[model samples]
Target chain A: MKYEILEHTADLKIKAYGKSLEELFMNAARGLMSVMYEEESSKEGKEVSDVVLETSGPDKEALLVNWLSDILLESDTRNVYCFDFSIHTINEQKISSTMKCIKSVAKEDVKAITYHGLTIKKHNGKLEATILVDV
Target chain B: MFSKEILQKVQKNIWEIPKSYREDMCVPARVFASERMLDDITTDRSLEQLVNVSTLPGIQEFAISMPDIHEGYGFPIGGVAALSVEDGVISPGGVGYDINCGVRLLKSKKTVKDIESSIVDLANQVQRDTPSGVGRGGELVLSQDEMDELLEGGVPWIIKKGYGLEGDEEFLEQGGRFDEADSSLITDHAKKRGRDQVGTLGAGNHFVEVQKVHEVLDDEIAQTFGLFKDQIVVMIHTGSRGLGHQVCTDYLRVMVQAMAKYDITLPDRELASVPFLSKEGQEYFKAMNAAANFGFCNRQVLTHLVRGSWKQIIDKKEDLSILYDVGHNMAKRETHDGKEVVVHRKGATRAFGPGHPEIPKQYQSVGQPVIIPGSMGTFSYVLAGTNESMKQSFGSTCHGAGRRMSRKKAKKVIDYNKLKQELDEYHVVARAGSARGLVEEAPGAYKDIDDVVNVVQETGIAKKVVKLKPLVVVKG
Candidate 1:
């Protein structure tokens, strides 16, 4: 799994090369938490309450947006800070994921998704998604 | 971002570039900003969208953007354009997803002096009476027929149902009624979202604040607005709620087909639009108007609740009246330059000057009142429209304190616990759907509203009437 920050803005483009799409989806969830608290240390003593989300899209870009939006909205609405996530992205049009939010007290709020530099591409050997989450 | 080649100074606070700036641009891109505000013009793709707005068919004059303009999905948040009704284009993105999300001002006879001791109770009462949070429904559940009447009748429908006040219809913009709405055009999904959401505060930058008239800038206009120093006022900032969101989501797909049918080519797919007078465009206009009417009904019903709470607390029975209600996000059909034009103002407020047939007879002598609300923990302003706005910017003005930082950044740095503590210390009661939401909307995340207000005042787009400070805020 590898990620690169896009130039000129706070956005990330990630590539997770795995034999199966499940591994790719889980890594993407980890990528999302890294943008905020970036760890599980504060969630050490907390019991896990898994929040599952199911989303589908006609295109990968829209799919990625719906997936991230679901997670972000759930985290904000529930007042749960997330550090660990496990996701299952079906090659079909949908992605199913279980998000675990850690109970931590710091960080910023996401305004909404911006269309600025949004891209999702399927390469020869890897699936890559680029998203700009408003800080 | 604007290339140095594309921009040239027209005068103070005004920048202009030719229609040839972009290949698809059909008119010049014009923006208003001071030397300071223009320094960060390249911060986002705002100028790009501003120029793209010029490409719409039948766009009259130049594409105009307010000083607080920032990049948004389809149109820049503060962008405005006027398209000819007969040949122009109507785009959903041009009005924004959160349609009719606007500000409503209500003034009470009970001053801050009278409510100081019971401020916390009042705030709590407001929070309890109004529902907050995402997917939060309300007490009133309307049937399909009632929903139709609400859409066509706007506030009058709510008023007739005993959830409105006397003189409210007159004081509100358009008497809280717009004849352009045809509820038959609204989709079942849109109606479903609004069925139980009236009087509820939807999440993200929406709130009901009990404010005190802190400063009277223009006394004559303040008097006309029935505001006095120390008087208590309530400002409800919200719109059609879930219904509006569904309306936009439903249309985005419809517009995709509309774009193909109309054969309109644009560089940005999000700006998918149909020509004015087309079946698709007229349907959207009608649907948008219906959502705007729903917004009026939402505010009207909320006002009745606030009035009841005010009456409960104050010893003396006094009138709490609606000062004005204006839609900051919308697209309207109006006559400009002797031609009927479709005006799309996304994240911008309409600032029609005096003597317009649209304004109520009472305010006809004082011009339209434009309510510009700041975020929670900040001062909101009431400004009156100016003739200069009608002549230069199609009777439009800046809406509020524009976002300088994203919501994600706000939640990251601003501590939610600390924010609640600080507000409590100041005796400003705060309530929210989520604690994190409170931090996400911290005043630090936005531009200096005073600066934004000053530009409008100096530019004569709108002049300040009275400054208001929040005593209690119910945030959702």
Candidate 2:
């Protein structure tokens, strides 16, 4: 999968294209974490039990926010890295997914998820997601 | 759009964007800015954000932005808007992520000359005593029960614990406590995030600077705040730390649902809000107040820690006291526009006029103290509110030397060693856990605070009391 970061804002932006929903969601989460955490310092660890999330937004932009919000919410609340997620459903208004959290107490933490560059669109027949994380 | 094309000049230093900007907009967007800063910042998304903010339900006559405005999440960093309490909307975006992140100023009887030789020792003491940087915890750890009380009691609780002075509380805005805070509205997770974070100087633009009162512009107001020329003072800039951030994030999820429940339609989802009288809105206010109180309490506790550092570093028996504490990112139920409105000021400080009920009796003749910190190694400001600000910005003023360069950009352009050398030349003793942090916060990365303060002072929004030059800096 490959992604592009849009110009600038306090919140980060990334457009990821992948062959599978799991790959795309994983890349998107990775993109958001890079802004708050020193990505160079992150480590892969023992995987925790799988957790599923389901949320429905009124539109794709809201859907993307809900998707990422669920991942981040899980991280802060659970105190673990939500390393990956596989989307079972991706629609304009709803999503269902199974996510894996790196089950370790983390040294890094995200302060908040910002509403900067928060939008979802399709470009060149590929899904694009841009979101902001407030650290 | 924040296009001045739609704005009508009602008077000097005030511009209005009518309600016609959008159908959902409850009122116009009012801006408090110099013609120059307005022109410079409005070209970006900040103005559009202001207009979007104006569209929030129950927003009063206008949404407003301060002179030191910049693009931010939902509201402009220096944005202010009040919603009719009975009908207006409440938004987490309006208060920002850091919650009650604010500034507290403390004055010392000693002159700058008296402590000139001990600058390094004082800074080292502060860094050692005051918790700072990412993932740091301070000496104060509130149990679940204590945090609940702290949320409601605010600075008074801190003072009770021997953190501040009786005179200090009398001078604080709202006596440094937000009364509406409902502990029930805060989640266990949020309380946990904040529990160990009290007295901490969080990362990013957060700082604690020991400064000297270099100039006093208003003798009466300066005297009211116990500020004197050459007097040494310290400014602690921080907020509810991790807890507030968690609260805002927690509420944003609920707000998104609230928008749909209220059938509120908006151009941006980030502008999600619920009518102020709605259950969700009231809960947000309660929770936000709790967070704001947490922020207030956090600063209060920090004041105590700093006092400890000062007494030990300089002289154990020397007297040290607080001047004023002000919240920057907060929402309050206040009277404005001849009505009760819920005003949300994110990255803007409340500057209530002298006689406002919120200000304590001791400052009835001088208004609230508004401490605007400069970037590291720069001059800080002390301004007093004017009735004009009360009439104009829901009693608010510019918060700080708004950033001109991104931290990433600053780190690239400002060499850490050179910046340190330049600061040393100014006799600004400094200590930081990270050299990278020093570079990211280079004074060159921000607008000249002198310029920002002059505009606010000249506009009569707030009168300058004194200017503070850094004596020593401690970063976290």
Candidate 3:
């Protein structure tokens, strides 16, 4: 279980788990940065930015909603809060990654990254997905 | 997963579900609600997302929702459909990621007994001149030719860059510009996330309350819009922040790859679609009317910063006018029953009755005000629009008090200090950026804005004329 938080009523559902497909797109960017910094827990000593991204969608659920909407638009236009995702090349359309961001500060406002009940599943031999953010 | 025993009662407080309960419906789906709010709207996949919005394509006479229906994310939050601009389809998840998330009311000449001792310093100076949480950013930035003259001169180009006032663009709505907005069809990352989020207020359940006029159910339509009773008003709620959530995440990823070059098969890839005269649906309907003219210039620059916090805390010539500015996540291009469709209204509310020739001739004999807003210590409304809501709801209604619990069950049974001691036992004067976004906007997590405006004034779709309550709320 690389991710879990599901229970939406007005957006912010998660499910992520994987065994490849670049670890379900890096646990769906660690379940959209753990439900967007769920009440901000310390991410200590700031200034750590490594970025590098790329997107393409045609499949794999629009390449996982253009890879978590380009890590939520590089964490809301570079205000910064992304997490540890490092998928180096994915398929079913496109992806390339490298992450680790921080200048954090987001106690809610993950407003877009929804394909409602998106899918990316498999059973027994594990793999999962269930995203939806729009908070 | 469809049940409410396939609803039927299609009249008094309406309800239907037909279209053979599936097999890719193309019609039947209504739902005004009340039969005890249809057991809290069939306990929620919003009637299977209004039966997948009656299977899209050219939807017309049905596919409605408005009893403040819930379960949003691809049209369910108080939905409404209407399609057919010759041939339908235009889903930016049917206008959800805050494209024109709206509400605006204002109207102050002092009351609540002349501002009961300046209600908590006018809600802490209107939450310090309107800069709210989550990616805040305000103090009016712009530039990029003033965000393309505010994405094509909306709010009369922010009232000629002096923010606003002079007849606040005739009580808003379309007066706040929508000349098929086209700031070069948006993007420069939606103008760098809406260059400094014009007059910000960007969190969930956005707000900026401070009301009063508690009750007057139509004294000649609340004196034709200048409302009365204990007077003092001001509502706000927000929209188009982060440039209408990145122009709906850049056209729902260019309509999910132009829905395979317009073959448009959808059972929810978040309702992605094309053809409203494709070219990627007329460039996402002119970039969603330039993100709805940056949501009417981000609530007319937060009504010019809540009229400079009611003239810096209740005096220096406090006027605060503009009595209407609705938008409830739009789509517009109406005409109804005389054809030319395209309505949409996600989280509905248009309500254009009483001599509707686009209202405002001093409210053309009393209509088009319809504000709604409740939850955050309940009671809020203003209602008007009718001709029986343009023959039963194409002139839509209902926009708030909708969420029936679940910001994770309202933060697992609210208790942010007992919901701030029940909003200080209703003397209110809250203010937050997050006390868990104020216990996930708890007013018992909504639905009961007087039973959703008494099912839109007992089904005429809208009429109630006043009742407001809160005395300063402000959130983000």
Candidate 4:
């Protein structure tokens, strides 16, 4: 599993796992998308649009927050559901990705990606991070 | 890792964790809650978050938490910190993502009997008039220039546009507008998200509730606020919607980078900070004020919509005047103990005491009316700020019942159909956007509001004025 929902009292928290840094970023995006649209059931006649997202920060943790924040803002402002995150390039400070998005209204709103207790770590040959999202 | 044993009882309902508890803490961490409430409080990381707040530069006296304090990202919800403007730092995390997420009380002359027959229709009418639910936009759309003007002008702009009744702005904090707001400082992305969200009640604990004055605890103060027993009133609980959220997200990134330059280190990155006088800090302060203005204007537009709903179902001539509008998430300049400080109230309401210059003139004599909204299908309260609060808690009090359970736990334990049936049994006409949303906000997820309020009253921070029970609840 790329991500699993963690119990939080107020906001939403998720732990995403990846085999590599690029995979970690992709999985984090997927985790965010899963929360916004819980049921990934149908895709009939949905408008498909190709879009690229790029964000850079001082470090990996900040980069992950900015990346998810970019996706959240794009979803809210454009009213589109982002899915299938395809990371073309990623580093400790920057990430670039192209995703196939569907023209569907979001089922919910994830307000912001927070850096509270955020740390990217390697464990048992897998990269993982616990992200707190303000909903 | 916090436990009840480490805390020392300061008074009847106040407890303190001295600065000795943590080597990094600059001051003590104080909490206002009864002994019984400590069991629930220690179960979360809220106290540790409070300790983190104590370590912030230039924080005054002690870091304070109200009875409703709950674990949030950086600062705990229901946390209050007073920082010296000259040396203190402004953290976006301190004000929370939903800037000015607040509550406003609208007083009507009619009693419950007058609107009893139309309760269901009234709830449906309000649900139709106000745009709510997740990711929903309102009918009123603003152009880019108009959006900037709205960000600068706030509630007065709404009044000038004929969206609000005359004298509506007077009852709001800061007269419903912060003059320090600079619309140019607000980012384009924030503007884009907020342009059409002026009259929306965003989901996740936001609502427009029709309540009745079930009990008048203090008749004199209740009368001063134009509330009476059995009187029907409307409470609007919302904030700046997506615009405010984006602003916080934008600044948190900026501050995180700026922190390295300032040589400031914190226990949590979410509590990033820079000196209040720094260039980046000033820019963020201006941008935050702009978002705060947007929050006040959002509620004002919703008030206009709710008024329209009221006229359609009840008497067309019925007048619904704002009793008070209080923002729980904000940072404001205020004087306590003759020293000016920037008070950050994240999930905490500013309850300026009686005769405080910031309060409305009429309410100044009795103190500001602190509107505390309980969880859905629970009893809310109207309390008056007291002088003691200024000395005790920087003129602040609890915001709500505060979450005691996770959303996941609530949904798992609560049956939506049964919850709806319970609301029906209580004569509450509930209009929810989603069944899952309704279950997540189940009253069982929150602490017992009555106990929270009793702690506030016992601490003498705020005096109870009246108790309000919902007649109709429109959940976002």
Candidate 5:
């Protein structure tokens, strides 16, 4: 499975898995989008817009948080819902990506991405991460 | 990793983990909970988080947690700490991501008997008049200049704009404005996020509820606050929406990077902070205050909306006055024990006792009004600050019932139809924008608010005044 929801007392948690780092990041974004758009109606009646984003962090965890934060910022300020993500290049310190944004409404407002008990690990030749989102 | 043996029982309802429990702890950590409540607290990392909070520099007295404490990012929810302003540090996590997320109570002239038949209509009207749910914008969008004024002037500016009633500011905490707010310190991105969100209630636990005073625990104090058994009141629970979240996110990054420069090391990166006197700290304080102003005005607009909704079914001239408004997540500079300290109340309420100059003159003989909302469909409470709270808890008390079960668990265990039927049994109406949201906030998800309030009262931090039962709930 690409992603699964975990139980949290006061927030939402998602566990994502992928065969590669890029896939892991992509799956995490998809998981967040799923939480934010729980209703199918939010996905209808919107034209897609192309957008490119570039950011770098000291490590992979920071990079993941930065990437998600950028998505949240764009979704709130630009009034667009992200439907898809494509990672062109990713390294230890930098990542470049293109995301497809659609004109849709959200069903939930994810306040911020938290770092509490945040970790990314590899097992059985696969990358996995458990991320918590403050709703 | 916390063992029960590490805690020393201080009293029937108090427990303490001495400074020696952790080598780096600068002060002892204390928790107020009954035996039953302590078991729930021990199921999570709240105690360990409290120990981590104790390690912060210049933390005076004790790092404390209320009975309702639960696991959070850094400091646990229902946490309290007082840091000496002269030598202390300010952590953004202490004030939480939602700056000034608070509750406001409005008392009406009508009683439950008068509004018994119209509860459903009132709930429907409130849900329609108030813009709610995710990505929903309100009718009152602000220009950049007007937004700046709101960030600084708070409810006063909103009142001048013909949104709220005049003299309403008198009933708010800090008169609904913080003098130190600096709009220039607020980022443009934050401004953009807030421009359309004012007067809107965002999703996930934010709500507007019509409540009835079912019981009066302290008649004298209830009378002083204009509350009587069977009176109908309105409660609004929300905060500085996206603007506050962005402000915290922006400052957390700054503080995380500044930690190394200041030669500071913490057990967790989420506890990133700077000395209160530092430039970065001052900038964060100013920006935080600005976001808090946004929260204050946000509630005021909702108050106006509630008043309008009430007018639709009741008399147009009927009075629905604000009893009190308090910010549960905040850091305020106050004088404690004759020393200047910045008290951080994450998921706690300020319960300053009688005669405190910060309260309104009319309430000086009593104490600051404290509103504690229960889980959806449960019993909420009204309490007053006490002198013992000022002495023991830095003038703070518990905020709510606190979560006992996770939202995911609630969704799994609770049948939505059955829950709706249960509310029907209580003569309560529940309205929501999403079905999943309602299940997530099921009454079974939280601890019993009565138990939480009893601990606070027994501990002498706050005294009970009244108990309110929800008659109608409108969720975002």
Candidate 6:
């Protein structure tokens, strides 16, 4: 399983898993998109706009937040909904990726990606992370 | 992570975790909640977050959490902290993502009986006229110059544009504008998101509800505030929308990076902040004020929309007039106990007592009106600030019923159809853009507002003036 939505009292939480760090980030992005839209159905044959995002953070966790935040900003500015992501390169300090988004309305406003109870760790020989998004 | 063993009950409805509870805490943490409410409050990390807030530099007295306190990113929702401006800090998280997320009450001469037959039509009309739901922009699209003026002038600019009525400024908090707001400090991206969002109500708990005065707790105060039993009122709850969110997102990044430069360390990245006097801090303050202005203007335009909607169905003589508007999420410079401090109220309302010069001239003899919106299908309230509030909670009070269950849990347990049926049984009409949204906001998901209000009144923070029951709810 790539991701699972978890119960939170006041926000949206997702637990995503991947065999590799890149896959973990990809799954996390998919999880966020899923929360913002109907991920599976919205992805069918829609016109896509490809854009690159580059950002640096102090660590992997911060980088993940920055990466997702950049995408959120782009989504708001371009008035589009992102459905897919490809992480070309990612490290402790920086990341570069191409996002595939379609022009569509968001189902809900994901105000910001929160750092509360945020952790990206490896367990049982697989990478896993739990993220909280303030809605 | 906080245990009940560590909390000392200070009084009947108050709990305290002293400064000694944590080594990093600069002050104590005080919580106002009933015994029953405390049980639910202890189920989450809200107390832990309150302790974290107490660690901020220059916090005075205590890091206080209201009866409606809930877990949030940095400070718990319904949290209030007064930080000394001389050497304290300003954290965006403290004011929340939605700057100036607030409540405004408009009283109408028409009573529930007068509009009983038209409640459903009024609900539908409001939902249609006021742009709501997710990603829905209002009809007003502003140019850069116009956006700048609106950001700086707030309700006055909107009124000049013919979206609001004259003399409306007197009924708003801060006169609906912050003179310190600087449009230049706000980012282009933030402006882009805000340009077309004015007068729009975004999703997630933001709403326009038509209500009736169910009971008058204090007849004199109620009469003074122009509220009578069974009288109709309109309540609008929203914020600066995408603009405020972006401003917070943008500044959190800046403060996070600047933390190293200033050699400041925090327990949580969400608490990232700079000294109030720092250049970055001032810039954020100005930008936040500008966004707050956007929120004020946004609600003002919606007020105009509501007035227009009401006029179509009700008589012209039954005009709607502003009772009061208050910002629940904000950080403002104020004096407390002879010291200047920056007060941050997140999911909390300011309730300045009588004789405060900041209050309107008409209400100078009484206190500021405190509008506490209940959860959907629940009983709301109109209260007045007290001098005891000024002494105890920095003139702050609870903002709402507070959520007992998460949205996910609400969706799991509440059938949308059944929920709608229940609202119908209560004669409370509800209209929403999405059924799922309505399910997520089921009234069962929230705490008993009566219990919450009782705690506030018993604690002497605010005095109850009137009780309001929702007659119609229009949501995003």
The DockQ leader among the candidates is 4
TM-score of chain A of 1: 0.75
Clashing pairs in 6: none
- Specify the poorest-scoring 10-residue window by lDDT in model 3 chain A: A37-46
Q: By lDDT, rank the candidates, best first.
A: 4, 6, 5, 3, 2, 1
TM-score of 5: 0.97
Error of 2 at B247 (Å): 1.5
Query: What does candidate 6's lDDT look like per residue over A15-131, in tens digits?
Result: 999998789988988888788876555656778888898888888888888788888888866668776688888888899889877888778688888777888999999999988
Clashing pairs in 4: none
Provide the DockQ value for model 5: 0.69
What ordering of candidates by DockQ runs from best to worst?
4, 6, 5, 2, 3, 1
lDDT tens digits, residue span B1-476, model 2: 35667877877767887887677677888777666666666666887888889878777767888877777877878888887888778888889988888898987889977887788888888988888876677777888888888888888887887776675676566777778889989988688777788788877778889999999888888888888999999898988877788788778778886687778887676667888888888898899888888887777777878888889878788657777788889888877767898889888998988787777677779887889999999999999888988866778889998876656677678988889899989988888868877887889888778778877787778989998999888886
Q: Candidate 4 chain B: worst 10 consecutive residues by lDDT?
A: B331-340
Highest TM-score scorer: 4
TM-score of chain A of each: 0.75, 0.71, 0.32, 0.94, 0.92, 0.91
TM-score of 4: 0.99
TM-score of each: 0.84, 0.92, 0.36, 0.99, 0.97, 0.98
- Name the docking class for model 2: acceptable
DockQ of 6: 0.76
lDDT digits (tens) for residues A6-114 of candidate 5: 8787888879999988999999988888777653345456677998999777678877877887788788777677866999999867899999887767777889877
Question: What pairs collide in candidate 3?
Answer: none
Best candidate according to lDDT = 4
- Winner on TM-score (5 vs 6): 6
List the candidate 5 regions with Cα displacement exceeding 4 Å: A39-45
